[model samples]
Target: MRLTRPFRRLGPAERRIWDAYPTGAWVDLRTGDKDTDDPVNGPAWGPDRTVRAEVIAALLLGAREPEPGRTAGLRLAGARVTGELNLSDAVLTGKLHLLNCHLSEVVSLTDATTSGVRFRGCEMERIRAARCTVNGLLELDGSTVRNGVRLDNAHVTGQFRLSRARLHAPGERFRASESWLEDARRPFTAAEMKERGLGQDQWAVWAGGLTVDGGAFLRDLRVTGGLRLIGAKFHGGIYLQRSVITATGSHAVQADFMEAGAVEFSAGFTAKGTIRMRSARVNGVLSFSEATLEAPGRTLHLSHAQVEELIWLPTSVKGGVNLGYSRIGVLFDGPASYPDEVRLNGLTYEALRGRWTVAERLSWVCRDSDGYRPQPYEQLAAWFRRIGHEPDARRVLLAKQRRRRGTLRPTGRFWGRLLDLVVGYGYRPWLAGLWVVVLLAAGTAVFAAVPPAQIDPDEVRSFQPFVYTLDLLVPVSVFEQRGAWEPVDWTQWLAWTLVASGWILATALIAGAARVLRPSAGS
Candidate 1:
């Protein structure tokens, strides 16, 4: 298409606008026949037909000249605007709406100030709204931004809706992919997302550090590149329901240190990269009930995060989820079928929401199978005891002990196993007493056949076996039967063996008694 210089001929409306705003260069964009030189051949040309960068900027700011000024407002539809929409550092009070319009270059509002500005169903080269302040909403819904939307530090006073918007343009930060959402009508709560998960082949958007004063709705969005919202904050709830994002290289949704009211990735939400929420603070529930997180390492990197409500992940994670050093209200809120997959090291949860019994709960805590992690078990046991779940608490501690035993050397582990059998780790003390009774009966029978006169120098008769056995076995107590009686050569060996048996039985009994004295473990 051939372009002409600033319009040599202007219609009545075009002349009026050019005369009022004489500082801009209006060009014949030649988008349609409406800007023809002859009015009879096509639609009448006017200020609306002008496709100049400065002209659009002045109109958006309600200025008659290229410099910043105020006017009633501007609402242009099906218009063609040329050059970058550079409104940076300019202040506009009225609503500036550009509907179904096409831009020739990037829309740069970097560090610019404005009120309610919207570009519904418009086609722009790109956008640079970084550090801009929108006193009202700055919407771009149903629009196709070719390059990308850079709202890194932009502040929006009202709601920010990027719902169902098409974002393209691979950026230096992340590559771009087509947005293909799986489901769009589901609720933002992520309730029905169990079994069903997210789907995405590529990732696209990278709007990190975005701050929204009002509610933010990213629901039904589909991105092909990384949606890096690291350190982003919203005063209200952030809905990511039915959105699919991929992390070709970077994280799919890296919202680290983000603070929001209710941040959800519930229904039909799928992510390929790490959904990092490190050090994030959510005032309400941060749910991913039916979402699929698929990063190989650190799939859901939520370390040091504080969520006020339960962090749901029933059919949620695909690769693995890391909650290390995180503080959650209810840590595990789903099925305990495969507990070994979730990492809960250094995690502290107030309540556990699993249908499993006390043993099952203990089993879930040790699911990582990453060897003995004393901190995880200790933290879990402490939490269980705090809520008067004494039995559960004891079970957890027992699990910790067992886990620790498994990692010991062969000799140490064997010794531990011996203790487990003898007294059930001090769990059963009666077995020690039963051993004493059996040993006393055997010793009494053996000594009854031998007479004390032949074994001793003094003239003593046959001894009472029961009395003699009692004196020989009771090492700590004095029964005084062996004082005057002595056994001959071979008989003396039997008596000495009995003395050693007495010492062994006494030690076992004391050990069992000590275990019984302490708190009892759950059955």
Candidate 2:
């Protein structure tokens, strides 16, 4: 076994780790909580449980030669590692397993390739592994990272896990005095931790362009800053069940342009800032069920994405949710799940699953922030038509015309209202028939009371009041009474009024019927 330094210069704890390096045995130096434990109290650790990072790195990088068939690796626990573990650009064949250790400086694995790495229950300042590759699993479950973890453009052949982890943003400083660091009787309180810089609007996990062959499990993860995975590709899906991300004035989780399988952001998930997933592609379901999103600006922006199915039933949303220009195979949502403002323009869904009435669903479309958009109405109407609800589909189209009327000029609006009152924008054809019947009755009564003198007294046809009224009202057919009899004074005026009303009714009826009969004209 090779050594970076002579064995005579090694410390007691370092010598113990070196002796166990060849056999891959664990060098458990943990005694109690005060020995070398805790992330924030690393500065107060004694020399008994301390391990130099260079010594450990050298050993992992072929400093020690194992037996012919024995696997050699570093299995450390409960140690305070001083100095930086810079393994950048190195190809390591051995595995690294650290448990409950506290490393004071940043661990640089930039551009390095490793077999496997596990940091279970460990605490580190940061991990800078940009563009690195991992052949096996990279697990960090139950660990704490004070600054951040940057795995940008990295590729992992196995699973990348961070379940039950706590991560803070970069540039966070420990502001406690040296006297308090050594003489403090207990851990800092929550308020004191805030003063020590717990929250910052930086990237806690910037894994943009990362490609993971297996799943990225982030369940129960707690992050104090943004968790960005923009343009990442995950073949086995990304799970975030019960995760909580708090980053005010910035995006809490930004997975824009990400391609994944069954991304689950459900089950008690909470985020303080926006969760943007613009232009993403998901092979399976993307859910946010039982999640809580609160942001001053847009809470969710899922525009231009394509997903197989979507389950969006968040518990509460403080800011607006935008799903504009997206396409989904199936959608599951509810009225109570929607916020006051939403953007559904150009969003297309094949099937809808909910126990909501047509009115409630229409209300959902009306909540779009862009006022009245015809596409949303058309989309909803098409869904209704697909479900065999022809009347409900017409109702949606009618509402669309009513909303569009408000955007027109005064004369156009007047004409629109006339169409609405007469035919309900072609959706209610019976309204025109009802008006025709009512006007015909009134015209008959008026002509019966005030009969006019006959124009031709020698004509054989009789002056029938009801027949004359019918002749005046009907534009298509003419009765003989209209040619034989003439109306003067009040009767003449009533006849002229009936003829005008008849023309208007016939025109309206033709227009409404054509619109209803032809699907393209109705749309």
> Top lDDT: which candidate number?
2
Model 1 residue 209 lDDT? 72
lDDT to native, each model? 0.66, 0.83
Model 1, runs deviating above 4 Å: 1-53, 65-71, 169-204, 314-316, 336-340, 424-475, 478-523
Q: Kindly list the per-residue Cα lDDT of model 2 for residues 386-496, writing each as its tens digit.
A: 989999989988888888899899998997888889888778988978987787788777767877778877766656666777788787657766666778786677778
RMSD of 1: 9.8
Screening candidate 2 with a backbone cut-off below 3 angstroms (N, C-alpha, C), the clashing residue pairs are none
Worst 10-residue lDDT window, candidate 1:
179-188
Candidate 1 lDDT tens digits, 1-523: 3323244654443343444343333323234543343222222334555456665565556544343443445565555666677888888765667666667588888888887888876667678888888888878777766556778878888999878766653432232233212222123234323222222212244456778889998887766556767778888879888887755443677788888988888887878667888999898888787777666555677889898875566455655667778888865475632424667798887887656677666666676747667788778777777889876665576566667778889997885666555554554555566666887787777777764444455665656878887787778548667776777657777778778767766665666456445543311
TM-score of 1: 0.72
lDDT of 1: 0.66
